[model samples]
Structures are given as structure tokens and as C-alpha cells.
Target: MRKEKLKVLLVEDDRIEVLKLQRSIAKDLDNYELTLATNGKEAFERIEEDMPNLILLDLNMPDTNGIEFMQIMKGRDELLHIPVIILTTSNNERDIHECYKLGIAGYVIKPLKYEDYEAKIKAIFRYWSLNEFLNY
Candidate 1:
């Protein structure tokens, strides 16, 4: 039997960050499909169309930040089950605490070094690949 590819939704506004994530996914991960959204509103729209297996969210965006997205997602039963991991540059304790309160699957601080960032992304993919999740 062939395994289905994991669908990932990446919500980020920065072009450079999106490029880095694409590179990381292309280089370090396999058996996955990625969908990109520039901000929370875009991501929400995409989710309405087709729910992804997981979401990689950035904390800062012009229209809707990560927290706001989470808040919106929390109210929807269909969307609430999807795992959302915050992949952001912010290292603020308050931000971390707030995300946890919002029930994030994980919080990752974006590393400055390219190699470190790649390694972290690789680990995330590997772990999620092995882990079990409910079929939607």
C-alpha cells in the first residue's frame, strides 16, 4: 500500500522566509505536499477549501497574526484538530506563553544559521512523518 503525502500549509508573509522553508522542504523532506499562504486570512481561506494535515505558522503578519489565526481556528471544530506549529523569529516569552495557551502543537524559534534551520526543519518533518494522526 502506498502512503498518502502529508499536506502542509505554510502561513508566512516574508518572501525570504518562504523561500527558506521551500528549500528546507525540498532538501530535507519527502512524501509531502506544501501549500503557501501569505497571512492568516489567506491561510484561513485555503483551509476552508481543503484542510491540511499540519500548519506551519509565523507569528507576525500585517493583517492577521498567528495568535489571531489561532483564535479564529479555535472556534471551528473542523479546523481545531489540525496541528499548528509556530515557526517564527520571535523569542519573546509572552509570545511563547500565549501560543501555548492557544494550544499549539509546538513552537520553534527560527534559527539564524542556515544549517541549524535546516536541521530543525528536518527534525520536524521526521517526527511528524512517524507520528499518528486522526484521519480527517
Candidate 2:
């Protein structure tokens, strides 16, 4: 593994969900350097400031929701290439279709069980880290 941690920006509004992800990363993903943004508006600011290797986004937020954010990213040459994975609870067909249309890297439903959620998190980290997106 690389000594330097991978930058991972997570855009989520739910406080409880945020806490859950944080704990999972702290316990399992030492290779990632996680950053938090409550909404798409804040997400852009963080992206500009640091440039994460990967982004984990939630579909529902207070402002500038995930779809809107993806639309905006498509127009920006600098930000367009950053991979975004949807980590949301929504299973609506439209939401999935729209997200895939906007070119999300992956879509993962947030499992109801904490253990299941943690497993997904681990899998995400393992796959991404193995590819070593940060090396690019």
C-alpha cells in the first residue's frame, strides 16, 4: 500500500449517516483521508481546494443535490474526471437511471444493517485502493 492516504470526499447531509461512515473508515480504512461536505455546494469548494481521488456522494441533500452536482461537474474540465460513487439509500429506478446517465462510477444502496454497510464500505475501499486511484 502507498504510504500516502487517498483523498476521499464524502458529500452527505445526514448527521447519523456521516457518523457511521466516519467510524467505519476510522476502523477499517487507514489508507483513505476522508473529507466531509454536507451538500453539493460545499462539495465543490472542497474539491477545488484539495482535489480528491474519489468522491462518495449521496443522492439526497439540502441543496445542490447529487444529480445537479454531476451536471455541474460535466461542464468543468478540471473536475469532470474525478470518479464519483453514489452511496445512497434510494433504490428508485429513476434515481438509478439518472445517476448512471450522469456517469457515476458506481451506485451502492446503503444497507439497513450496520454490519452490511460496513462490509460494503470495506469492499469499496479494497477495490478502489487496489486500483490505486491516488497513484494517478
Candidate 3:
């Protein structure tokens, strides 16, 4: 039996952050097929096309916010099963609570340093990689 490579949908608006994530994931985690979405609208389209194993989503977006996106996703049975990890800069209590309410798999605050950010991303992948619960 062959292990399947994880497909990651990265929904981030910042260009530099996206690049950094790509480089870090490529360097440390080789078994990921990554696709980017610059805004919530784009992310929605991407989700419709291909439901990735994991979604690294940013809360603040142009077309639509993460909260709204999550609401829409949860309503759809077909896309609701896919795990969504909130990777965002907002560390506010309301944001965290709201995200949890919306059933986000995990929430991560974006670090100022690139190395720390990379580590956090790696940790998320590592946890999911070994956990059988998310395999479904």
C-alpha cells in the first residue's frame, strides 16, 4: 500500500507570507501538494474544484472573512468534512472563540519571525500526519 501525499489549500492574502509558507513546506514537508487562494472568493472556488486534505485559512480576507467562509463550508455536507485549520494574524479573544464556534480544527497565530511561523506550520502537519482521526 502506498501512503497518500496530503493536499493543502492555503488561503492567505499576503504575498510574502504565502511565499514563505511555500518555501518552508517544500523544505521540511515534502509530501504535500499545495494550492494557494489569495482571497475568500478564490478559496471558495478552489474548494469547489478540489477539496484538499487540509485548509490553512486566514481569517481576514477581502471578498469574505474566514468566519463567513466557515459558515458556508459547514452548511455544505460535501465540503464540511475537510479539516480547516485557522492560520491567521488575529490573536483576539473574540476571533479565537468565534473560530472555535464555527468548528475549526485548529487555530494558530502567525508569528513575526519566519522560523517560528515555519515551526508552527510544521507542527500542525506533524500532528495531522500521525493522527488517524483526520484520515477520514
- lDDT (tens digit, per residue) of candidate 2 on 6-72: 7889999999999999888886566888999999989999998999988999999988989898999
Model 3 alpha-carbon drift over 4 Å, by segment: none
Candidate 2 lands at a TM-score of: 0.94
Q: What digit string (tens of lDDT, one per residue) describes model 3 on residues 40-85?
A: 8898899878878889999988888898889888898888778899
The stretch of ten residues in a row with the least summed lDDT in candidate 3 is 127-136
Off by over 4 Å in 1: 28-30, 134-136
Q: Candidate 2: lDDT of 88?
A: 97
* TM of each candidate vs. truth: 0.94, 0.94, 0.92
Best by lDDT: 2
Please give the ranking of all candidate structures by TM-score, highest first, separated by commas: 2, 1, 3
lDDT for model 1, on a 0 to 1 scale?
0.88
lDDT of 1 at 66: 95
Candidate 1 local Cα displacement, residue 93, angstroms: 0.7
Question: By the TM-score metric, which is better: model 2 or model 3?
Answer: 2
Instruction: Give a tens-digit lDDT track for model 1, residues 1-136.
Output: 2177778899999999999988988954467878999988899899988888889999999899999999989989888889999999999999999999999999999999999998998788777766677343
Clashing pairs in 2: none
Which structure is stronger by lDDT: 1 or 3?
A: 1
